[model samples]
Target: MASSKPKPDPLSIQRGDYARTLAGPLLLGLGRMVSIPLQHWLLTAHPLSHFGIPRPPSDGVLELPLVGAQPQLSTIFLGMTATLILKQNAWIWGYCAERITVPFAFFGVVVPAMYECLSALVFSYASSNPLWRKEFLYVGAAVHFFAAAVELGSELARARFKGRIENRGRLYKGGAWGLVRHPNYAANVVYGAAYGFAAGGPVYALFTGAFYWSNLTGNATPAKENYLAERYPEEWEQYKKDVPWKMFLGIF
Candidate 1:
């Protein structure tokens, strides 16, 4: 009887990703925390609050309390995402740079703008109304952080495989990469939904989730796959055969 190939241990490898420099991840995490909040404040409270002027009664403004359970919950939820971004930066900057490239400027410019606009609007609409129950907030935060964890795992896996193979140019399939062709993208979509819920409520989650889906499927995934296919034809084809879904499990 032939023995089956041993599965790679997900936690067994380290490529000195953190030893290089933590500045990048720390900055990124800080940026992540400020990104949406700055947008939210600018569109809602900043003009008045910054200038010490009384906020005029307006139906279109976000009126989240200065301190409350809802705002606190939002902060905690968003904070976890920011923390994960910092934690995962080592894997992303270390491993992803080898095989990944900015396929288009749209992702760098347009998508984030869209997300900010959507989030700002959601906050404006939902901040006053207590649309999120405590239970729902707890569940949403768990899902968000879980997806962030998955993203971190995927990056670590890629870095580990790259280290093991000693091939800087080929696709690495050691850790979470084996579970899905694009685990990062899958996790992003899941986290987006969680962010949406935290930002606004269920309605916001729907909008954010749809945006992530479109961004991943319509723009990012195809471009990445095409580049990989061109760069590593035989390996890419074999990879597709082994891992069929572009993102997530049998869903995509």
Candidate 2:
């Protein structure tokens, strides 16, 4: 009989694993950088305007009254907002890549991004409108602050969500998470609403808010809870008892 092929060395396999461990994070960083220009163009430039839609009057300038008075400030804020969006997009993409299962995973990744992209596109047009009142800028600023608060709250929840350490996972039940089981989704709700507020119209508000709500209630929240339930059955039971609502306070 032919001699059996030599067994692969376990140490070699371990070394390969070690070498490839940083690949995910590295690619994530590179992808974020590479995507910046495209995202900027999509959000600010209104590339689809050539297809019968109106574009911003000029590049990188919001056509709104005082906002257009100082183009640089508006541009800086726009860039910052877009950067935050890209960062969040990368984070959720990573989450879906790692945690989501098939048959539903594709939907999970695409839906949330579409909601955000729609909001951004609407805001681009809304900001480009010269008809907005000066006071509405204050409204936009206030909503921007609210969105920032949601972001900060979600960050705090992430700090508390120390997951699967040494294969012994611990459920987060303090801070923002204490108020709602899905603080992250709540943040996304606030974010979506803020975008609507910034856009400043009844139609945009309804569309953006509905899309955001559907993403959380109809998509992300259920998928997240399902995974949480499977990953930490006992802890998830207790968590539900302690925090009844999935995305809202006193109501879901």
Candidate 3:
């Protein structure tokens, strides 16, 4: 009889897996670098106006005013003025304190702070009036605001979630976790793609996705699973049974 085929190793990294590990980050980074500037460059180089679009800087400088180089400006605030109602634990300090460095945490605090400021700068610089007719300051702000809120609320609930903990810092229940096991990660994918969309040009659309992908591999992957699994054994396994992966809203 022919020898039994060698069994694939469960822990071994496959060729495709390694390629994906490299490709995701590389593509995302390259996409951002290539698109954003290309859009800006396209806006600035023209002398004659196209389709009634306003003109950009004649000197060919991309101010990146979103970075706060503009004068007499302010921010756009979209926040949880209303307290997020959620279950808390005496031992967990309300879930917000534990994962202080999470992306959703930074997004909550940062996006609103910069939204109006960036929009104001983009318009002030003009670079040839709105690249797309569908673009608007309110729309972009709303998108970022919504995504940030979802991410933040979900993350907070996750921190205090009671369930499996492959690690001391991880879990499998609570908040958005009850719906989608990878709520934070799902939010990242949404907002990452939306950032380029909000930028309102093909350039950002092409590149920003790569950044999110890279970010997921580096930050969201093990932090959400393997790390916790190693720390907490029985709880995590049970949590996995209680919730499904990527179900952010609900499961029927």
- Score each candidate by Cα lDDT: 0.61, 0.56, 0.44
Per-residue alpha-carbon lDDT of candidate 2 for residues 1-252, written as tens digits (9 for 90 to 100): 899845433311221122333444444344344333544566566766766565433323456565444343234435545655455555544432242223233334344445445544655565455554334434655665666667665664464355447433676777778888887777666666655655545556566678778867986677668768877899899989988988889779
How many clashing pairs per prediction, in order? 0, 0, 22
lDDT of model number 3: 0.44
Query: Candidate 2 — number of clashing residue pairs?
Result: 0
lDDT tens digits, residue span 1-252, model 1: 999845422222212123433443344433444555555454546353454443222323233577534345445544654554465455445554422212222233344545665565454444354674445556777888889888877777666666765676688876767768899999989988887876667877888899889978997787678667877899999999998887878888
Clashing pairs in model 2? none
TM-scores for candidates 1 onward, in order = 0.65, 0.61, 0.46
lDDT of 3 at 130: 47
lDDT of 2: 0.56
- Tens-place lDDT digits, model 3, residues 116-182: 2343234334445446323433354466567667877776555545333553444546567776667
**In candidate 3, where is summed lDDT lowest over 10 consecutive residues?**
77-86
Please identify model 2 stretches exceeding 4 Å from their true place: 1-73, 76-80, 86-124, 127-134, 160-167
Q: Using TM-score, give the best candidate's number.
A: 1
Candidate 2 positional error at 60, Å: 13
